[model samples]
Structures are given as structure tokens and as C-alpha cells.
Target: MSPRAQPRGKLANWGSSFLPGAYAGSYVNIGSMKPDAVIADLKNGSLNRSEQRKQADLLAKLNRGFLARREKDAQIEAGIEAMEMAFRMQFSVPDVFDISKESQATRDLYGDSEYAKGCLIARRLVERGVRTVQLSHSIDGYDIAWDTGHGDIKGGHARLAKACDQGIAALLKDLKTRGLLDETLVVWGGEFGRAPTSEGKNGRDHDHYGFTVWMAGGGVKPGYSYGATDMFGCSAVENRVHVHDLHATILNQMGLDHEQLTYRYSGRDYRLTDVHGKVVKDVIA
Candidate 1:
């Protein structure tokens, strides 16, 4: 998917694109406000304590009513989940993002880029019960910068890979040390891969025909590569895994059957993998 598709403005739109109504209200941009300020505001909002209690009581009542309906109402359940998450985050988010709490050696292991910091934050979040965390390699705040199409691929890819490699390595190592790697899934890839053929002098154009993605932990076999590109690294030659398959495998790792995990919208059900996806069982442990 194009980075342009991702909204840079409000969190609602972004959440809708990825998870629809499920996370719209739970959107928290760690980049926007300091965790301390967010916690403070949540505690000392315009509403007084009694009013807040009443509101919480009302929400609980509504949630019970929604649960009694027996319909798989994603919007209702998502709203309830969002409210609960928001409340819990008031206490958890601050400490989770505080990298200063990490040892100096751990900090050095991950390097010192915003992206690297995000990787560390991801580990912390996962350790604290966040199920999913995404860390992208983008020089700018947006994801489009990873589209390396122009100028020296050697130097450009090297610089980009250096930070990503260090951070991901550190993350995997940290998770393993804490015995979380077995339960946590780590996936690394881009929207598309660069073509093997040259673009200008050293750069390469986007190649949607074939690319590579790797998975670690979460039931995947360790140190085993599943597929292959041609000798020139242009296209997949065997054991091809489509993006849908990737999604299915990830959901499978999280104990969710991708086909069954659907949300109702406009009188129809939609899922992350749509109507297609087969779990690549060969890669599983």
C-alpha cells in the first residue's frame, strides 16, 4: 500500500484504514503529546470526579447492553474497548515510552535514531500487553521515504539498513532474553522491493512482482528461509507467499483465524485478508 494512503492528520482516519472502528477512539500518537501531560489531562479533565464516574458507569451499562444483543457488533465492542484502553493507558503509556528507564548498554544496542527508539518502545509496549506494534523505516515522519528509487542504492540502502538492522537485532535479542520472543511475532519488510535491474546509475525502481519478507518467533521455525528469488534477485521462483498469506500467517500466530476474524460493515463482512489467504505452514515451528 502507498504511504500516501496513510493519513497524517487525525488518528481516527488512520485507525479506520487499518482496523476500522475498532481502534478509532483508542488512537494515541506518541509523537504528539508527552505521556506525562496526557496522563495529567486525563486525570484532571474538565469533567469532575463524580461526573467522570457517572460517565464510566453509563458506558459500562451500555457495554452490557451491547453484549446482550448477541450480534457481532464491532463498532459497539470497539467503542467499549477503546474507552477501557484509553483509561488504562493513562497509567501505562508514560512508563512504556520512557526510554531513559532502559540501561545505557541497552540504549546503545538499539542505536539513537527516532526509528530505533520506536523499536525499543515497541518492545516495551509488547512487554506491557500491547498485542501489535508496527515500526517503519522512514527518514521523515512519513513512510514514503523508504521508497529508495533514486541515487546510489549502495550507500542509501546501507545507511537505511544500518539503523534498522541494529534496532531489530536488539529487539529480537531483548525479547529472547526476556523469554518473550517465543510469544512475540517479528515481521520485517517494505511495501515493495526494488527491482534488481538498475534504475539510473545505481538505484532501482519498484518491483511489485517479487520481494522478500522474513518472520521470527511466534511459532515460525528459526534460521529457516522459505522462498527464493531468481539469481538476479528479480522475482520469486518458488514457495511464493502473497501478501494475503502473510496476513493469514500473522493472524494465525496471534491465535486468530483470519477467515473467521471479520467485521460487519454496510451489511457485509470484511477482513484483513479479504476472501483469500492460506497460512504458510512450512514456516511454522
Candidate 2:
């Protein structure tokens, strides 16, 4: 009962943490927590020091089985298979990371590289009934994957773009071919976009003022573009869509009312839109 205790937002469900969205599970840090303790410790960081230490040790063992070079092959494979099965129980694709010969064509079409492989895998996941799939540009914890301006923009983008262009184009083409495009939503964008004014060298810096992000399928009107930037592409000029708006539009397409999709916690309701979202009707069918 203090003024500072005023309700600020809506409540949310603990399980909704698994919900798919823009960055679907991006912020989770499983570094020092065991798989069993993930949800519990993540939500309530009040575990005793001893309990925390135990969790950390379990996590270390799990990491070794998955990444340690000295670990036995049998142990690693077993761990992987178990994890795959667990993922299957919740996700539509029971195989989790299973790859097939038929996927070779899809992979090649996406570019036959890691990026392409990932995109191809994403296509497979969505096709198998997964609601949302997110593929980050980072190949191996290297931000340089997309932070091209750091050095060699031409070479960097060329290497990455070859795969990206193929993967994205193939995904769009494949989705349409199979009629999955209507039910599946595809989003392509990053935290922000690169600046239009070349870094005066080769690459460009981050430009939040204006950038480009496109969405296809999932009830979105095809061949229709949204928003525009200035001549220099430094700022949004017309029909600018904010990130919150994008989230709103996505939730809408999923048949969830952004405002009503609430989770109750601590006597309040919390929703992803968080008081700021307008369904961009123009972008929807």
C-alpha cells in the first residue's frame, strides 16, 4: 500500500516464457543452471548458495557432454538424443535436429552453407508444425556476421549475403509452393538496420532512425510494402512502423489479441504489447 506500489503492467504466465515471438527465448541465460532448474531459478533467483552451486555443477556436466572434446562419443550422443526427445514432446518435430536426404535440395537452394542450412532447417521446423522459428545471423558467437562495417563490408556481406539471399528467397519460395505461407508468418529483420550513408569507407553504422524489415505470408498482404525512409534512408518518412507495432501485428496474425493476451502475476496482468501496440491493419490481409 504505497504509491510506488501502483500496478504498472499486466500479469503473465510462467509457462508463457516458452511462447514464440520476435526473439523467441533470446534472453534466456542457461549458462549456470541445470535444465531442470531453468524455469524455477530463472523466475525466482532466491535459491541458496549451495543450491546454486549444485545447479552450476550440473550445468557444467551437461555442457561437457555436449561440447567437451574429451567426453566419450557414446555419452555425447546419448545426451543429444535425450535432449532431442525432450524437444519433440513439446514441439511438433520430434526429431528436433534430424536432417534428411530430401532436405539436401532445400539446403542447396538456401545456399548449402551453415546459414543456409539453418534457414533450411527453419523451413523444416515450421513445416513440421512449429509455430515460430528465429534464425540469428551469428554463426558462432561472432557479431561480425552482420556487423559488416567493422571491416571488409563488401567481402563480409558477400559471404553472408550469398547464403542469406538464397536462404531467404528459398524460404519465401518454398513456403508459397507448399501453401504453408498462408498460415506461417515469416519475419526478416534485425535489432535495427544499417545506416544508408556508407561508413565513408565500406560498411555502415547502426541507424535506428530508419531501416528496412519485411514480413511475408501468415495472412500478410503479399507484394505490399510498409513504411519508408528519407532519401538518405536516415529516418522513417511515411507510415513508419515502430518495433512495438511489429510485435502487435505479429501477435494479431497469430490470432491473439495483443491487449487480451495477459498473464497474471503479483496481482497484475502483463502482456507482451505492454500498453504500446497498434495492429498495422494495412500490413494484414
Candidate 3:
């Protein structure tokens, strides 16, 4: 998906619009959840049997009310799945987010930044059956620092790259070691790339025409590069894969037919790729 007004907004878009019903019920922000408190509550057994029964009853009532209002089976299933996820998270969140339980070497591999922690958490989530896990790199509230603008391009990019390089490499390596890499797709890229020409003396502007995005594992050929940009890196020169094509390729990897994965909204069927996209099968393993 494309970047939105804010990182959270982009996340919301992915949850609400990109895959539509598939993820509408699973949107969560780890930043807002106090995992320690959750763990404490779980350990303390604060809810008595009677209180637990009451809460369950209330949840069932709410589920019934929700199902009554929704016509689509997918919507009903989404609500049920959300409820199940909430129940599962009560146990999973504590274990998954607890990086302290990991070995010192593992921790060192991922470094010690919040962003790096997020990447580690993403791997945990995937291992625990999470369909999608987005790790955003918006340090100090800058959503797209890769924009470069009038900043020092080499220094800025290098700093950000250094911050995430070890963590990402660690994540991929860990996944491979666990035999999960074959099934887990890892995509790396920005919303757009920087321009070939300098914006100022040392910075660059946005370049939408030619940008590089890479995907690994999940049925994609390893160590393979598809498509190309011009000599100046200003435009796509060969095997151009549009955004829609990328979406389609990802869906294909997930065993989904992009055209058939539609949700009904506002009296029409909406899909992630709109009315466009062709699976770039050449990239498939």
C-alpha cells in the first residue's frame, strides 16, 4: 500500500481499505497496549469465575448484535475472528512482545531501537499466525525521511540504513533458521524512491517514475532481480511493474486471486488493485 498522511493513517488504510474485510477486525497498535499490565492481569487472575462468565455473556451479546447488523458472511466471520484474536492475544501478546526472554545474542542481532524491536515483534507475530505485520520506520515523527529533500542524502540514508540493517538481517536469518522463510514473505521498499538529480547541493527530490522494491521468499526466486530503470535512474526502462502489478504478485504469493478478492462497499465491489494488476509470474519461484 502507499503511504498516507501519517504512518498510523497508512496502517488504518491497510487495515480498512487495502485487504478490506480480511483485516478490518485485526487492526492493533502495539504502542497503545500496555503489555506489562496485561501480563500482570493474566498472572493475578483478577477476574473471578462469575465475573469471567458475565464478561463472556456480554461479549456474546455484542457479537449477536454485530451479526444482526451485518449482511455479509465475511463481515460476520471477521467479527468472530476478531473476538477469537482478542482471546488469543491475552496469552500471546505477553510472550510475543517479551524480547527480554530471548538470548543476548538474539537481542544484539536486532539492536536496541524501538524500530528494531518492532521488526523483531513482526517476526514473532508472523510465527504466531498473523497474516500481515507492518513495521513502520518513522523515526522522531518523520514518516518519510527517505524523501531526502534538502538534507544530506548520504548521511541521512546511511543513518537510517544502519539503524535497521542488522535487525532486518537478523529477522531474515532467524526466519530461515526456523524454516519459516519459505512461507513468510518479506517486502522492503519505500512509498517512492529519491530522484536521480540533486534537489539542492546534496539532497534529492521524489522520484515516482523509477523506484526499486524487493521481495524475498514466499515463492519468489531468490537472488533474482526483475525490471530495470534508465541509466540515470529517472524512469523505468524495462519490465515495468506498476503498483497494481505488485499488489497482484503479493496476492498470488499468498495463494489469492487478486481479481476475486473483492469486498462490497458503497454499492460496488472494491479490490486492492482497483480494476488493474497482472501477477508478475516471472518473479515467482
Top-TM-score candidate index: 3
TM-score order of candidates, top first: 3, 1, 2
Candidate 1 clash figure, as a count: 0
Query: Which structure among the candidates has the greatest lDDT?
Result: 1
| Cα error, candidate 3, residue 93 (Å) | 1.2
Residue 119 in model 2: shift from native, Å? Answer: 1.7
Off by over 4 Å in 1: 1-20, 23-34, 37-77, 140-142, 260-264, 268-271
Better of 2 and 3 by TM-score: 3
User: Cα RMSD to native, each candidate?
Assistant: 4.4, 13.8, 4.2
Per-residue C-alpha lDDT of model 1 across residues 1-285, encoded as one tens digit per residue: 111123334453346664546554333344432556423355645776567667877897889687778666666777777776666666567787788899999999988865677788889889988777765455645645565567777887887787577888889999999999999999988668888888889889888778978889888999998888889888898899999999999999999999899977678889879999999999999
lDDT of 3 by residue, 142-244 (tens): 6664555557889888888887788788888988888999999999887788888988688888889999999987989999999999999899989999999
> Would you list the C-alpha lDDT of every candidate in the order shown?
0.75, 0.62, 0.74
lDDT of 1: 0.75
* C-alpha positional error of residue 218 in candidate 3 after TM-score superposition, expressed in Å: 0.5
How far does residue 261 in candidate 3 sit from its true spot (Å)? 2.9
